[model samples]
Target: MRRKKQIFLSLGIAIVLLAVTWWVDLWRNTEATIQVLAARCDIPAGSRIEADHLALISIPASLNRAGYLENQELAIGRWTTGFLAEGEFITTNRLHDRARGLSYPDAALGRRLITLKLEPAAANGFWLAAGNHIDLFLIPHSQDRESEMLILEQIRIMAVLDENTGHRLTDTHLATTTGRLICLDLNVEQAGLILGRLGSHDIRMAVVNENPTG
Candidate 1:
């Protein structure tokens, strides 16, 4: 009976030890380092990232397990969707398609989304999207002036519209391709300035944030 008791105790101890080892191994695996691509320099939003600007690094997988760039090819030929400091791991949300562009949230800090309708020649061939910084050029359609004047600069495009069809592109879809009006996000004072210039000056949308490489 004593031998039987000893055997049962040994079995219980072994089971406990096995369970403890499994837990430790699971913890270690979760904390394991994963290979990912990171920016080597300060890559600004809208800049086309290349291999020279990237480096493969091993990092704690669980630290930022979500949205990590898993391959070098994924990093190449993609635009930085937002500002990326040096040595920052490239994530899915941090990159964008080269043809398509980035869009931002609703304007904050005492700003409103102001919708402004401009001619096709004025709105940059319908390539406008949210988060695009634009400058409005007022070419005097009247007899007052022969030269072009800068009426508005650094205006943020909050939304776009298909003026003919009246569709609002909130998320920048195929709907924006037919978009004509580039909505501006601005303060009360700024809104007054843009609206006041409409009659005499024909406003044109120039994307100031177009790829610097180009």
Candidate 2:
């Protein structure tokens, strides 16, 4: 009789422990926040959100809550939870979209893509990578010609092509490549002006430093 009583007591304790654990897990899951992407206020789609414009908020228990939740803080440029799959908990601050000012001409319309060959000596040992901003230093020909070294600052590197594979180099090689064909973001007129003076003068690239304020 005593043995049977002891067995029942053990079973009752186990059930109580399981119930408490399940309840604790349910409570924690409810407390966790779900992140989503939305306007800082009300802005049109496709309009760029500046670094100072957008904010991040955390929602608890609900994935598709319409209104902003209380006690959630704005993680400036950190919550970019747009276009996420369902049931995913939004953690971390990498969800914010970067702000870029639109100022380039429509090169896809009728312009040509200029390929600038960077000599290994002048191209920082081919350490220059694509998507980096560079200053173009053009050493002009003699006075009989146009002997001047004009510097164009903040020219973006569009593509970095490889000579061997005839393919664009990936970001992995960006750190230590010896040669590259860098595409410049310039229109036909600007392209013509730069290319026309290429061979007559020395063409070198200078990496542009990021703005201190940014």
Across 56-135, the per-residue lDDT of candidate 1 in tens digits comes to: 89877777647688689987888887889998888888887773444445768667567877656667766657778888
Against the true structure, candidate 2 reaches a TM-score of 0.43
Question: For candidate 1, what's the RMSD?
Answer: 15.4
Q: What are the lDDT scores of the predictions, listed in order?
A: 0.75, 0.61
Model 1: CA > 4 A from native:
1-105, 143-148, 164-167, 170-179, 210-214
lDDT of each residue in 1-214, candidate 2, tens digit only: 9999999999999999999999999997778675554345544223433434444555664554544423234434343434333333233332445543232342345545678776676776766566778888887666654366788777777777876665777662344544567777766666777878866878887778767687
* Highest lDDT against the true fold, candidate: 1
Error of 2 at 198 (Å): 2.4
Each candidate: RMSD to true structure? 15.4, 11.8
TM-scores for all candidates: the values are 0.42, 0.43
Best by TM-score: 2
TM-score, candidate 1, is: 0.42
- Residue 90's lDDT within candidate 1 is 82
